[model samples]
Target: METVSVAIASIGRETLLDTLRSLAAVTRPAGVDLKVLVADDSKSGAATKLVTAHPIKSLDVTCLAVASGNISTARNALLNAADGGWLIFVDDDEWVEPDWLVKLFDCQKEFNADVVIGPVKPVYPDNTPDWLRRANPLYTDWGHRGKRLYTGRGGNTLVRVDFVRALKLRFDEAYGRTGGEDTIFFAQAAERGARIFATDDAIAREHVPQERLSMNFILSRAVRAGQSYGQMRLARHPDPLWHMVFALGALAKCGVAGSLALSFRLFDKARSFRMRQKLSLNMGKLRAVFGRPLAELYKKPD
Candidate 1:
């Protein structure tokens, strides 16, 4: 029987309970020994307490008290604890479908892929702003189904344990607090000849909270994404000339985007917002290229 471990790294969010419940309700695949692992990053051990109080009888669940504000630390804890041939990662704010595991396995088998990535759909609240709702910037594009990808996110992914062990892949501690650890990890895996493929059937739904609905949050996230991409590019190719070339390209893009945003501000609000987001992203890339410190977006208050 193939052993499979589903892992989650959390900061004690109330939505984690719902995520656990969804996992308990998934249809287990035949001949698969499945287990669920949760790494509690909350210093207070809130997730550990919650799991102890309300156990899922249908699933074999284990919670580890990591107590680290760093997401990479929590994920590394999961990686160390997992005793499975395959590992699946899902976010605390997201829930999977009944056939999520089966679909991921099917894709892996079909493509002979080392890493299989699934799509994440955002569930917006009714009270969300109309413009934000219409724009839907939270939705991720993983390209078409069965297409090969150079990198993938950790939110909804199935990884072959043998491939990971072979490559000695681990999330970078430098990006632990600032996000993009997954981007760097997957990019490294792909660079080392890991085949990454995407599947359309295995879907995870992420719940968007009220705190993330603001324009400020959206633009900030865009900047963070750009920073991650810039950092990853530099890490892959450490030539000083490459850095200068990328920085110049980002500067030109930023100028063009800023001008377009100013020109469309009065007439096309949505287009203007998108242009502004693009400008912020390029500005973040510039910051990364110049070795500026990144904002710790995931750090918990002391």
Candidate 2:
């Protein structure tokens, strides 16, 4: 069996501790050599210290100090450092199911996939409103899994080390601070004929911190998502003139969505989320066109 490197890039935050602990306790699949490599992006080297302190015996866990704040750099650091035929990326804030590796590996072999994307469940905080929980305001819809070519979040995904290494794929550092580096990276991979598939059962849980529940956080996340989408579309468009026209259309959508949000925000929970997210996405695309300041969500608030 080939080696599998479970790579996690963290900012050395307190939440990172939980993620590491969970990874340490995960059940290792039989006949597979799996190891955990944590690439730390904190200037303080806090994540490295944390990994050293916990010291999981189930799997070999190692930490490396990488970028100060850039997620792409941190991820790339792990890519270069890890030795694995199969590479699995789990966000530093997520906890994997005990059999996550087994499931992901099984799916990849079953489909002969170059990449396997999995679902990341949300761990809602206590005292959350029932309406918000029902709405699922945090996670995006992955649409029932199939042999689909789609760009997705970094919360949970597996990649063939050969496909990426052969092509020398790296997450764009430019988009690191602003977010969307993962979108661009996977887009490039898909274009290179990488077989990206999804497994619904292989799950990891992402903790939605209290700050992520605020209206401000939701809006910011929506905007970043839109900005990433716009950039992705623009990158793939064949003609520059057509891309410009498409961008204009997206900007117009922002105005329309904003108006609808104002009109219906009082009457509906799901409708409000749908309308507001639409508005935020369009606004983000507009910002991408004019070079607006990015809403850096990963950074600690001042």
RMSD to native for every prediction? Answer: 1.7, 2.4
1-302 in candidate 1: lDDT tens per residue?
Answer: 98899999988788888888888888778899889899999988888887888888788989998887888988889988889899999999999998888889999999999999999999999887677666677887786679999888889899988889887899988889988999899999999999999998898899998888788888898899899889888878799999999999999999999999999888877778888889999988998898888888786712
TM-score of each: 0.94, 0.91
Best TM-score goes to which candidate?
1
The reply for model 2, stretches above 4 Å from the true place, is 259-266, 290-293, 300-302
Compared with the true structure, the alpha-carbon lDDT of candidate 1 equals 0.88
Residue pairs in steric clash, candidate 1?
none
lDDT of all predictions, in order shown? 0.88, 0.80
Q: How high is the lDDT of residue 144 in model 1?
A: 68
